[model samples]
Target: MKKKNKKLEVRKPNQEVRLASNVYIILIISFYSMIGIMTLCSLMLLIGIIAFKTNNLPLFSQIKTVISTIMIIIVLMFLILYPIKNTIEPETKLEKDAFIFALNRLGLKSKCELEKLNGIIHNLKRDRLHFSSESDLYRIYLLLENGQMVDYLISLRDLKQLIKIGQKVKIRNSNLKLPISGWCSDHLSISVIDEEGKTFYKFESYEPFNNKTKLKGRKIVG
Candidate 1:
């Protein structure tokens, strides 16, 4: 007797479905960003209008154009400045000074003194990368002793991931040995230790630098 053959079917992802998912994600993010900016501008404009109304200024009543101009300026300033203030303010003159002081203490040259300073991620396409989101944090990079550059993305959640490109990082011990006994047994490993013996900050545990603890730049030079 001849045996019956069963046909196996392969299911592939629908291209349309994939495209729709991507579009949904993009729309959601774009919508949120737009909402945030618009909300801020609207709030500022409302506040200006309220204050002008409460003041009962003669200019607002006699010169409607002047009131309109002032309102426009207020809205424009809020719309343009809010995002810039939130995203770029962290890297300010004070931060720069702190970074320089930290680097000098570690004996590493400032980025200005470096021969080449560029983004670690090609897709970033910016010499100075600004990370406003957690996902962007992985784009940092470093230079190695062998004249080769290494990326921080190798280990997504690893300690090295905390180091940003252009940020000075000091490596105290790169070849820490793991013993083959007790809890860490059965594996031969080399660990990288920070200058202060602290593990790299995980995204969940990361805290913005405050006056108490300053951010420093240090690069390892063999």
Candidate 2:
């Protein structure tokens, strides 16, 4: 009986250990999958750029068509794969505390008080549906405290008629520390929450304002 009890205790921890390992593995895989897709898109973009610069007209023409097709596929995939409804998973107090701690360590200010402000969507433009653009698409000037203005680049698709100016929207997952330079800046994922609390994922542009708003929306910007 003593030996059996000891074996049961060991088995309990082993099960827990396996469960924890699986969670980490899933998170890692999700992170890497996102990165990989973005990287592949970047490579296609680089090839197009090199061909353009070298005056390889035939190569550029061929690649442009292929890249465009791949981008369409990616968009369709995202729409099909992602859940349609806004669902927030409930977190335990301990899990919530740990998440806050991790955010603090990442140099994010106001980690606990991060609130998404509703802004009127204006100056909307759709470039490549899947990638970044030279100019920030879905532009909005977020009203901030102390009369300061925070200009943001909203990056997402299907915005042609879905959003407009004068429409108040609530936003979530606002990150303040990331630089606004390229297409794949390390900004936090932001979701637009409507008045009814429906959350929709959208990309924000984090680059400085250049007067030109309309440009070819591609992966790389010069």
Strongest candidate by lDDT:
2
| TM-score, cand. 1 vs. native | 0.21
lDDT of 1 by residue, 162-185 (tens): 444344333221111111100111
Tell me the tens digit of each residue's lDDT in model 2 across 1-222: 001111111112344444443443344345446557866876786576555644746776767766775687577546533432111111232222232233234333321123445454434444344355433365455543334454444543444454454444444432222111111111233344455556543443232223332222222111
Tell me the whole-model lDDT of each prediction, alpha carbons only. 0.35, 0.39
The residue ranges of model 1 lying beyond 4 angstroms of the native Cα positions read: 1-16, 52-56, 59-222
Model 1: per-residue Cα lDDT at residue 170? 31
Residue-level error in angstroms, candidate 1, position 138:
55
Clashing pairs in 2: 118-169, 153-204, 153-205, 154-205, 155-203, 155-204, 180-206
Clashes of each: 3, 7
* Ten-residue stretch with the least lDDT total in model 1: 178-187
